[model samples]
Every structure is written in structure tokens, then in C-alpha cells.
Target chain A: PNADAYGAARERLRNQARPAGSLGILEEVGARLAGIFGTIDVRLDRKIVITCAGDHGICAEGVSRFPQKVTPQMVYNFVGGGASVSVLARHAGAEVRVADLGVDWDFAPDLPIYHKKVRKGTANFAAVPAMTREEAVRSIEAGIEIVDELTAEGPVHLIGTGDMGIGNTSPSTAIIAAYSNIPVPELTGRGTGIDDDGLRKKIAAIEKGLALHRPDPKDPVGVLEKVGGLEIGGLAGLVIGAAAHGIPVVCDGLIATAGALIACELAPSARPYLFAGHNSVEVGHRYMLEHLGLQPLLHLEFRLGEGTGAALAMTLMDAATRILAEIKTFAEVGINDAQ
Target chain B: PNADAYGAARERLRNQARPAGSLGILEEVGARLAGIFGTIDVRLDRKIVITCAGDHGICAEGVSRFPQKVTPQMVYNFVGGGASVSVLARHAGAEVRVADLGVDWDFAPDLPIYHKKVRKGTANFAAVPAMTREEAVRSIEAGIEIVDELTAEGPVHLIGTGDMGIGNTSPSTAIIAAYSNIPVPELTGRGTGIDDDGLRKKIAAIEKGLALHRPDPKDPVGVLEKVGGLEIGGLAGLVIGAAAHGIPVVCDGLIATAGALIACELAPSARPYLFAGHNSVEVGHRYMLEHLGLQPLLHLEFRLGEGTGAALAMTLMDAATRILAEIKTFAEVGINDAQ
Candidate 1:
């Protein structure tokens, strides 16, 4: 992000017809937007939410409430405009793009879904590496290529990270655990509303995976291959791709944020272009957000991730940029700020 | 609120193609909106934000950073589409309605503002009662009348409470201090960027006024007469009026919530129709919302209370209602919830 542009935007915001810094987080958001767009004239008119789906073999441990078949089912629901993110993205006036990273199902050829399959599904990290290093790199590249293809079609102003996978939260939480000394149990949460026994099983599985893999935080690709899902890798690529194209990325809840953590590790410059969409109910969501130094825009206590948080947050980004563009300065309004 | 309608709405929400209660706070908001509208079909279209401007003689006590003249100036800014709320309301697709309850400045008839001024301003509560009980009732009735008139023109779907009054926070905090045993200074905050000395003076003034007025929580009207701005009283009426008309009211920051407190105390039945738009940075805002048993939708830390928070919340209300109206059910998509 351009610091000079951010500073200039802040000065402009301070002069708007309101008390200085009274818009609170919005003022910071508007300035950051100006920095990202490299101008005060920021337009988030063309927005898209990328909902990436994959399957997790970790579901074999009974870590989630739903079966792995639900992943492909949800992708169809997303395309059919029936999912939560579908309605929300439509409400936000953004198009929803469904991508299959490695779901363990074959979608029909006529379906309007991106067929970017890296593998059938990730291997259970508790017993083996989630994916090969080559597959992990390929997954990220697929995401980057998606963004490139979309922007090639038009000037894509913003992108939102979304995910659909059974037991995906297991890998998301493990990613956070690898970055911090926080206990696996502390970072783990009940995905899709699990019982106490299921939660305990989840914690033990993550602990086992961590113990076996001993993933290094330094080599993010190695970590991704060892314990990350294909969709997560794609989402990380989405973040890096968005930053590379100078477009802002609104990262959804825990899973998308896990992807973001990996993206930032690989390319620290992408950190400046990202917005934590909301503080989810997942215990590790806020912890991971703090690690990334991103302040979430919404606190709706949302736990369902399909870019819903990102879609809602896009409205705020629109408001912030519109504020910078539409609101007149105190001088234009002939109002004395000191008075 | 209609309990039967709310339950029915919740049932429908559960039948939609998502996890049961996964949308979290939004699911509740959608159901409550259905209850308010008395059906599963909720329409938040044709939204309006009523910004009632008044003045406080309490400004003479040095409790605020800006002069009382800034109140009328802001009303002009709001009318001219140059204020923070103006841009935000426009962004949210809501119309801005500026009303004068007790502003000191006089305006020509050509200006597009509601001419409902009860008095030039209220008396300093630190020295005497803010208004006669008769004037307090009139202010609230003025708010109710405005809502009635607007709805009479068309089927109004939603209303948001906003206020513009210098030293208004002093009286607002006083209203809360009357109900709670919390320290007066704890409830008081820097209004419009006041210095520590100004804050000390504000707290001292509120404490002095509460001691002098001895406002009772049971007699809400008496409390308003003793320690409320005309805009606050008007906003209280707005909540009551919105409830009587079955239109949801999105209550904005400290001053707006202070008015809502008075409204709920006077008519407990109206409490169900109110939504705390966003938790402001004001010290007493959340405390007052808690007292009203209201949960804010957004946590943007917004302090510019010209219906700005309410306008932003209207979009969420739209999204929540649209979720119920647009998203497909499991049966419609031929998907089994158990899977």
C-alpha cells in the first residue's frame, strides 16, 4: 500500500464535514482504501466473491457435523443461488464465483463452476502429509490464475475469500496452532456445532498432526503441503493474487483467514491489501486475525464461512470509499472545524 | 412485536439451505423484523432516517468542544448533503429527513426541514429543569407526528433515530446516571473531541444536574423534562411511533439510545421494535442499550451520530430480510439436511 496516499486520504478525511476522526474505523478504512488504490478516487464498483470448495480426509475422524459429500452439494447450492453466501453476495451486488480445488466429487461439465482440481481430497494430516509440495504450489497457482483470468476479463476492483469443505476447520485451526504457542485445544472450536466429545477428538487429532508433521512456519509451502487443504491453498493464492493486482481482498472467517495467514507468510506485502471481514465465533478466528495484524470490520459473531462475512464487509468498503468521494470538506460546506 | 410471526419466521429460516442458526445474529434480526412487520414477508424498502436537531443551554457550562451554533450549522450540512450521515444514508439507499425540534437558529420556509421547533433550546439542567413537563411531552409528540405524517404519505418500512445538539451528551449521560449507580464521570465521555478539562467539566455538570433534578426512573417524562434535550425526547417518540406503526427503528449512538431509553421506559411494549444500529465509542451508549435490552448490529466504533449508524444498519436489515425472501429451502433444492 502507498503510505503517501494513505496520509493524503487521512488529511482529506479530517477535513470532511464531521468531527475529526469521528467516523472511527471507517476513517482508517477509507485511508487504507486510498492507499490500496493509489488515489483518493477509489471505486469498488466491480466486486466478486470466490467461494473455493475442497474435501478433507480429516472428516474420517468425525471432526465435523456434516459429511464430505456436503462439500460438492454446497458448491451446487452456491451455483444455484441458495447458499448463505449466495444470497449475501447478491445482496452486496457482487457476483459469486464457485471454484472446485479438490472436492471428492465429479461435477457435471455444463455446470458454471471452475474445474481447478489439484487432487481428489487432502490426505489426513494426522497420519500423512495433507498434499505433496508440488500439489500445494499448484493449488496456490490455480487461485492466482483465477484472479488473473477474471481481471483479464474486466477491471476487478475487489475479491472475497470463501471456502466450503467438511472438517476444513481442523486444518485452519492447525495452521494457527503452528504459528503460535497456543494449545491445540485453545485454538480449536466446534465447527458446524459439534458436541464436547467431538471437540475433544478434534483437539487430539490436531495435536497428533502437529506432533507427526512438526510443520515449519518459515517454509509456508512446506506447511501447506504438510497440513493445509487444497481450497485453503487456493484462497492463499487468491490473497497474493489480489495484492499483486492492486485489488483489495476481504477475507472471510477462520478458513479463509487461515489461507490469508499463509499468503502473508509467503508475501508480506499482501498484508496491506487485506481486510479481516468479521470476528467469527471460532476461538482461533480472532487469534489468527491478531497474528495478521488485521482489524475486522464487522462483529456479527458469524461462524458460517462462504464469503458471507466478506460480502457484508464489501458494503462497508463501498461506504468508506463513497464517503471519501461524496462528502464535502468543511471548507466546501463553509463550516469552521474549530468552532 | 408479534411472537407468533417471529416463531414462524425462525421456522422458515431453519428450512433454508444453510446450517440451522448458522447466520447467527442475522437470523435473529430477520425473525424480529418479521415479527415487527407481522409476517414472514418483511420489507425494509423505503427507509428514512429522521435527524432531529436541538440545542442545549448546557453548552454554557463548557461541557462540549463546539459552540451551540454548530448544531444549526450541521443541520444545514445535513440538509445540503455535506454531512457524514448524508453520504452514508445515501450509500445505504435511505432518505435523510432533517427535523428541527428546538434548534436556536431560525430558517426560512424555503428550506426542506421539518419545522417542529417547540422552543429555541432547553434550559441548562445544571441550574434548572431542562424543560417543563408539558414541553417534554410536546417534543416526543412532535417525533410521533413526524412519523405519522411520513407514513401517512406512504407505507414507510423503516426509521432511524439521529440527533444534532451541542452539549447533548451531558443531558444524555445524566438520563442514564439517574437510572444507574455508576459514577457520573464513568458515564461521561469526550463529546466532539473535548479535552480532559472539558470532560471533567461535562461530568461535573451532569452530576450537578442529576443532584438538582433528582429525576426518577419511574417517571420517564419527568426525567426527560429535567434532563433531556428536545431531540432526545423526539427520538424517544420516534421509537414509540415506529412501534405503534409496526415499522422497525434503528437507534443510533449515545444520544439516540438515550432517547430510546426514555421511549422504552414510557412504553415497554415498544422495546421489541428497536435495533441498536452500532455500538458507539460513547461510554454510556452500550450501558443504555443494555438497559433497553437491545443488541447493536455493527461495531464500527462510530461516534458521528446523525443517523449514520442507523443508515448503515438498514443495509444489514435489508440483507437479513432478503435472506428469508430470496434463499432457497432444502426441499426446493432437493438437498437433505441430514446429509
Candidate 2:
């Protein structure tokens, strides 16, 4: 953090003609943005959310309502600019980049998505380990390369994380349960508003994955290799890569937060680089956030995990940055401060 | 609310390619806005926040950190477009209309504010009623006329409530305590970050007003006449007028919520027409929202009573409306539903 810039931002806020501290959390948001950029005049441009599309073989267990085919179809929708993340990213003045992580289906060579498929899809963790350790490492490196390539044009200030894989939440729950002693039922939710029967199946499947993989709780990489999905590993690498380059990563919802948890477990130093986009309606979301010690910026009760929440939060963060940079001080505006 | 429009909006959302209810509470927000406008296609072209500026007479009890003189000066700040609400409202693409609900000091006759001063200020409520019943009725009417005149050309679709008054939280705490049997200390917060001594004084002041006025909890108008500020009265009327015109009123933090409580208490039908912008950091805000059966859209830890929170929420509401009206359904987009 730049003490000088933080001081300058606080001074400007103090003299903004309204009562001091009246802006509440916004004043802190402004000061923090200033600290992030190491300057009082912080501005965000050319923001992008990387939506990694993949598939979950665990969908065959009837854990999710939708078929795994929806993943590739949603990737097509992303290419045609019709997906939720597409609309919301554009709405928030940010671009979207949909990358193929490990979907089971193959795309045409001419498709616009960058192909870094570690495999067709992860092995159903309920039956076996999801991926080999080497494959997991390669997934992380692939995410790092994606961010590095995107920022090669110019430094991207904010990076949002999104994933599209049906039944991925089952694996997400497994990963959290593998590390923490939280019960599967406590960490499970209606992934797609499932019925009581479906939820029971989902919880059973998660427990089966834990029993089959026997993931080492002390080893984050082993846990990812055993129980986590490819997109999850990629998101973890994206967070680590962003921290390596001194940029902030805005995490979407539960799946992305699972990836973030893996990243934080892998490297505790990467924790500060992550920002929660919104509190998810998923029952396990509060547990994950409490584990992270982060608060989300919005609460619209969004259950979709498409980086849509991240896109909206990018706009609010931009607004906070603008306030820190644009508003005039008492000395500049010739207004008396409240006494 | 229009049932047909609500149904249409839901149908559109259901077929929008996302999972049903994946948008969660935003789906309800969209449907409500559609119902409010009597169309599935809802648009807000001209939105305005009425920032009612006033002063409280209870400051004489040594309850606030700042003097009462800061009220008009901040009003000047609002007019000059330099206050937090001014900057945030403009940032959210909403116009601000600052009116003189009752400031202790007078402005120039041709100043760029509506001169609807109910009185120089309220009487010292520690010893007497704040205003007579006639003055209370006139203040409410003045607020109604302000909205009526502003929407004379075309009805404003959204109205935001903001207030400026020193020592006003004292009265707000008193209002909440009057209706609910909650203790004052449990309901009160450090308004404007008052010190321990100032907080003690504020609680003592509220207790004095309650002891002296003995305002009836059942009689909201009588309570306002005895204990509430003129701006609070005006805000209640603004809410009523917005409801009368079939517009959505986005309620801000604590002080504005105090006014909203009065409005809902006066006309029960007005309750559905109001949207909570954010939950206030003030502890009583929870009690108030629970009483109204309303959940705020955002929880950014904002306690600023300016329509700033409302402005931010207006942006979100606009986003929800656009998603409802503009997004293509499954038939239009040629996309299969997740199921």
C-alpha cells in the first residue's frame, strides 16, 4: 500500500464538503483502490472477466438438473455474445473472454475461444480421482498464461472469474469438505434448485467422491488434483497469477470461490488479491466467505455463477475509484468543512 | 401492481436461457418494476431524488458533534453539485432536487432551491412539540406539491429520499423508539461518528423528548408534530405522493428510513411502493425493515442518509428492467433451456 496515496485520498474525502465519514464504506473503498494502484488518481480501463468453460463427468450421477452438453452450448452462447456474463460484462463496461478449460466436447478450430483443454473432462471424482497431479498443474499454468497473454496488450486492472460446468458444485462441495471438516449436507445446496430427492443424491455423491479420493487435507494441490474440477484449478491459477502481477481478481460465486480457496490454500499471499463479487444464495456461501474473511459488494440474491456479479461489482469499484480521483477538496472548492 | 405485466415478465425471464430462478431476487425486482409500470417493458428515462434539507431544534441539547449551522452550508454544497449525494446521484444518472424542508438559516430568494421552508427550524423538542398540527399537515402537503410540480411535465418513474439535518438522528432514534418498544441505546448508532460523550448526550436527548412529549405510538402525525423534523415529515409525504402517482420510491439509510416508517404508518398502501436501497448501519434499521417486511437490495455498510444509496439502487433497478425487456427469450435467441 502507498501511504502517500492513501493519505491523499483520505484528505480529499475529508474535505469533500459533506460531513466527514458520511460516505461510510465508500470512503474506505476509495482509499483502498488508491492503495491498490499505489496512486491517489486511480482509474480502471479495459477490464475483462475470464469465463472458463468446462464439463463435469459427475453430471452422469444425476447430481445436476442440466446435462453436461449445456457447457459447450453456453460456450457457443458466449461466443455469440448472448450469455448472462456477456450481457453483464458489457453492461459494466468490461469485456468477456470465454476459454475452454476441459469440456468433454470438441469445438471447431475456427471457434473464437482459446483452447487449453487439459482433458475432455475430469473423471467423476465419485468413482476416482478427478485428474492427475500433472494435469492439475498444467491447468493452473494454462490460466496463468491466459492472464499473461491478455495483459500483454496493457496491464488489466481487474480480472473476474467465471465457470460453466454442470454439477461442478458437487465437486466444489467435495473440495471444501476435503479441506475443512464441514459436513457435506452443511456445504451442499440446491445447485439448480433441486428437489429434496436431488439434493440428497447430490450430498451422497459428494460423500462418495470424498471416500473415493481420500484427498489430503494438508495438501491443496493434492486436493485439487483429487476432488476439484479443471475450471476450478484454472481459476485458482488466475488468482495466483493476478497477485503475481499485482492486479486484483474479482471472484464470482461458489465455484469461483472454491477455486479461490484452493489458491489461498496453495499460497496464502494471494488472499489479499481477491474481491468477493456478491454473496451467493447457496447455503455454503457464507461458510466459504467466512473462511476467506471477505464481504461481497452486492446482495441481489443471484444464484447464477457467470461472473455477472463480478461485472456489476467492477462498475461499483470503478465508481469508487472515480470518486477518489474526481471529487474536489475543500481547498479546491472553497467550501468550509463541518465544524 | 399489474398481474398481466408481472406474468409476462416472469415468462420472459423463465425463457431467457438461464436456469429458472437463477437470477433470484432480481427476477422479483424486474417483475415488480414491470407491474409498477403496467408493462413487461419497463424503462426509466427521467429519475430524480428529492433531497430535503432541514435543521433539528433538538441540537440545543448538545447532542451532535457538529453545530446546526452546517445544515444550510451542506444544502449549498448539494446545490453546487459537490456533496456526496450530488456526485453519486450524477454518477448514477439521476438528477437531484434539493428542497428547503426547514433549515434554520434562509437562502437568497432566487437561490437554485425550492423555498418550501415550513419554519426557520423546529422548536426545541426537548421541551415542547416540534410543530403544530397545522404546520405538520402543511409540511406534508408541501412535499406532495413538490413531487406533483416536478412531475407535471412527465411523471418521474423513480424517486429517492435524502435528508440533511444536524442532530436529526436524535429525532430519528426517538421516532423508532416511539413505535417499537426497543430501548434507545439498542436502536441508536454513532451518527456521523460521534464520540462516546456525544452518543451519551444523544440518547439522553431522545429520552428527554419522549418524557416531555409522551407522543402516541398509534398517532404518527401527532408524533411527527411533537418529535420529528420537518424534513422527515416531507420525506413521508414524498413517499406517499410517489405511491399515489404509481412510482417506485427507493428509500435510503437511517434518517430517510425514519421518514419512510412515518409514511408507511400513515398509509399502509404506501408500503408496497417503496424499495429499500440498503440496510443502514444504524441498528434500528433492521427493526424498521423487519417491521415493513422489506429487504434492502444492497448491504455495503452505507449509513449515509443522502439518496446516494438510492441512486446506486436505481442503476441496479435499471439493469434489472433492461434485462427483462431487452434480453431475448429462448424462441427469439434459438437457444435451448438448461432443462
Candidate 3:
């Protein structure tokens, strides 16, 4: 299986002449790929970041602290290059494309919007399922179509998934609990700095959805249709698509973590392709990371949810790859040390 | 007179339209110059880093954990692009030039070594004064001449000072206490991860030197000649030279701190040109920072020398300059806001 390829790659990278485990989590990334590809000569140059933007009907219930108008404001901020992710992408030298999967507002026809909205946003999942089964598959296929287009450009070395949706974390937490098999309390977090009372309300909403759709863990796509947001379902599709195509993907904070867990449940080998960027201050983040058996690199108490963490983590990846490819061997440098 | 310019510049940078105290110590760097140049439109394109290397005769007394050979080995590491400061300079887009002011070993003729040795390092400053008055002046003048040549290429915006000398901390501690009018114990620190017992011995050595010199703090150069290492004297000259030419200089950890204290004593205006990089983990670092009335930005418990800290701090300067120069005005963006 693909897991064997990742295991081999990790062994080869670790066996290279250096201090053992000196590279830390970077070594895990390289090893994971080596096992995925079944070869030691792995390369990571082409980077593609997919940002999914949607709107939540829960906003109508006054669940979020920020006005729903701020969603479009931030989308414009992304376009105007003022968002944190914009600077981070510039720092990482990665190409980014934004998609509007289910935003309530309309964007220009020529603005790279995917136009994959399923009813202009989800129905409040606390009240009912966000989308029907067929609609979830359609959104996921939209993400798959984007990956197919990106793969045509070149060998897609890495994929990063980011989401922008007001109140989407509510659905994401529900989907994570359904797939991760953790209790709703363990999977819920203070999304967007919600107050203690708001957190309690959010947890209650997730538990209500869990009661309505008792999803089977064995069928992740079925579970996603039962509870996940359109963006989360789309991200899950992207992860599975990248792994099926043998491309590595780095997952950003909590929302992306939920997507990865769903992808892994769908195809166990998909776990080999994913790297967790950082642990967010979100309470659900620890449960997600633990479920995935992942250890993130930086822990600076960051809770920003714009894929900024993934972009910063990419810098460390660049450093790791440069060191792996560029450092001279002992024989090449005339050093007498034994490997 | 120069100190007045520094104070004025510090005020203007603080008044820029942004979050109050958001840019941290970088605000002071900009403001210090606003006072001097009478404008916030400042430039920092050309940078010069002076690395002064010597050998401490106290190395012969087994005071340091690293061998005296490490002094030259690190010099080679700097030249070979393997040292931490080398990578940091490349990151900061700054130019680095090394000066072999004094080392016991003679290097190859074409090795880019600056022939400014002061009697193959110094007599054990623990046992005697490190250098004579004539030798100290010669070393300082050599540094001045180097900066003059470097500034001829362009308008030097920033200057940085670093050094390489084993057992140099003994002399540095003596200089810091004598100049700051602090007790020897208050000014001593583990220079390079020295043990608790070793630190006690270092403080004893500094106390002994203070007893021998009893230097007059008013006569900065005389104080330097009596207690300073060759590298420290050279750095003091570089600081003064950069200020005499109206270029801002960033002072590194402890050794550079000693040099800045000397520069301020010699030409009070030069304090405006000096930016302290970080509060190093050395026990004396906080004292040096307090004496200079500076607040360092980054605090990662770094004690490594070789100007690495200063090089990293330069990145923040780049960020600050970009914020000042590149961020759009509310009026320009057509946003109505109270300024």
C-alpha cells in the first residue's frame, strides 16, 4: 500500500549522514513522502494552495462575533493583499487561488470564483443537515476538478487547504466528532474567540446535530454529507484527490484538520500525504491532532485561521528541502567520518 | 549634540500613524533619526558589518571551554559561509566584512585577512592590561579606516559590530563594570555557557582587573586601553566612525554593548545611531540594555555571539521601513478616518 512507500522514504531521509532526529518534524514529512512514493528521490517544488470561502446560515442565528459582512470584507482584503495569508504566501513563494463554494454574496464572473454554491450557503446544521447527500458530492467534485486542473500545470508537489466561512467551525466540529469518534465536548472549541456562554451554546448545537444524523465512522463521505459544511466537504475531497494522484498536502489549522480526518477515514493511505502545520489555540485542535497522530512545529499561541500557519510552515519545509538537497556529503567534502 | 538628534528622531518615529508602540524597538530606531534628519522619510539601503577578531592571552590560562583554536576556526567558518551570522546576513540582505585584528596564528597571505594584529592578541588581561595605549589607538584607527572605505561605495544606512575572541569575556566584563560604574559582580555573566563555578571565577578575574586598572570612566579610550580586548576597541572605533558619518549602527550582544557604551561616552550624539539588537541571556545583558535605555524586540534566550542577533534584528528594520513606506494612507485609499 501507499503507507509502505511513505515508510521507506522516511527511513532513507533519516539514514542520510546527519545527527539523528536533528530535523525534528521535517524528517517526518520527508519520511512520509518516501513511504508514499516508494522511492528516496523525492522532490517538492510545485506548491498549490486552495482557499475555500463560503457562508453559513448559522450567521442568521447570530452565532458569530463578527458581522457576516466582514466575510466579504476579508475576501476583498485577500484580493487587495492586506490579509495575513497574503503576506505569508508571498513569503513562501507559493501560488494561491481562491474559490467561492457557497458565499451568499455574488462576486464578478471573471474573479476566479468556482461558482459551486449549494443553495447560497448551508441551512443551519443545528436545525438540520447542512446539505443533502448529492449536494455534498457535487461540492467535493468541484474541489477535485480544481486539483485536476492544477496537476496539469506540473507535478503538484504540495497542496495546502484553507477555509473562510463565518460559523463554519460549528459544522466542522460536528463532522470531526462523527468521523474521529470523539465526544462532542472533546471536538468543540471556542471558534473566533467566542465567550464561555457562546461556547456552551455552540457545543449544544453540535450535540443536537449528532443526535439527528448518527453517522457511521466507516463511511466518511456519508458522515460528511450528514453534518459537514460545503467547504469542509470540498477540502476533504481535495486531500483524497491529491493523495490518489501521489501529491503531498499540508493541512492548515482546525478546519483543515477536520477535513484531513475525513479523508483518512475514506482512504487510510491518504494519511501519508498530509502534514499538520501548527496547533491552533482552538480547543478542538488538540483532539484533531491527537486523532491524526500528528505533531505540529511552532506553538506561538496563534489562532489565526487564514492558512497563515501553513504558509509559515512552508518556509521551514523550504529550509528542510534545501538542506537535504544541498548539503555536501562527507566523501564530497573530504571528511573522514563514517556514515 | 548628536544625542539631541537621536532623541528628536526617536520622537518622530513614535508619532507615525499606526498602533501606538506596535513596531516595538524599531519605533525608537526610526524616531531617533527623525530628530536628527528632521523627517520620517528615511532610507536604509547600504549596510556595513564590521567583524573584529582577536585572541585573548587569557585563553592560555584555561579560562574558556573552547580551545583558542576555535577563535580561528570560527573565523574560517565566517569566511566559508558556515557561521550563523553569515546565514543571517544573507537573510537580512546585508554585506559582511571580516577583520583579523589580532590572532596568534598567521593565516595564508591571500586569505582576505586584514593585517591589524596588536602583538598576536594581548598579554593576559587577567594578569596585565590587555594592550598598551599606542596599540589600542592603532586598532581603533584601523577600524575607522575600514568603515571610511566601505562608506565610499554608497550611503551606509546601518552599521553592525561583531567579534571573535576566546576568553574575551574577561576583558568585556571588566570594561562593562568600569564604564557603567556598576560593581564587577553585577556586570559579570556566563559569556558562552560557562558553568556556575566558571562564572564565579570570571567575576573574580574581572574584580582583579578592576583593582589593577581603577580606570577613570570619563576617559573612555584610556579605560578601553586598560581593560578592553582588541576586538572591543576596534568595535568602539567603528561605532564612532559610523556616527561621525551619520550612519545608524546596530549593536550586538555583550561585546558590542561594551563598544556602544564607549561610543556614547566619547561622542554623546553617537547613542542616537546605536540600536540594541536583543537582550541576550548573559547576566550582564540586562545591565547593558538598561544603561543604554534600550528595549530589545526579540527575546529567545540567545547567547550566541558573532553578530547573529543583530543580523536577525535587521529583518525587523526591513519590516518597519516597509510599514512606513509601503502602507497606504487613508486619504490615498479614499477611506474617511480620523487621523
Higher-lDDT candidate among 2 and 3?
2
Candidate order (lDDT): 1, 2, 3
State the lDDT of candidate 1 residue by residue for B5-107, as single tens digits. Answer: 9999998888887677778888899999988888888877799999999999899899988878888888988999878888889988899999999999998
Cα-based lDDT for every prediction: 0.91, 0.83, 0.68
Q: Candidate 1 deviates by what RMSD?
A: 1.1
Ranking by DockQ: 1, 2, 3
Runs of candidate 3 exceeding 4 Å displacement:
A1-49, A58-65, A80-84, A113-119, A122-145, A157-163, A166-305, A312-339, B1-50, B61-66, B80-88, B107-119, B122-147, B157-163, B166-229, B232-339
DockQ of each: 0.77, 0.54, 0.08
TM-score against native, each model: 0.99, 0.95, 0.66
On TM-score, the leading prediction is 1
Candidate 3 reaches a DockQ of: 0.08
Give Cα distance to truth, residue B300, candidate 3, Å: 8.0
> Every model's Cα RMSD, please?
1.1, 2.0, 7.4
Model 1 stretches astray by more than 4 angstroms: A337-339, B337-339
| Tens digit per residue, CA lDDT, model 1, A109-195 | 789988899999999999999999999999999999999999999999999999999899999999999998699988998988889
Q: Which stretches of candidate 2 lie over 4 Å from their true place?
A: A1-3, A14-20, A328-339, B153-155, B335-337
Q: Which stretch of 10 consecutive residues in model 1 chain A shows the poorest summed lDDT?
A: A330-339
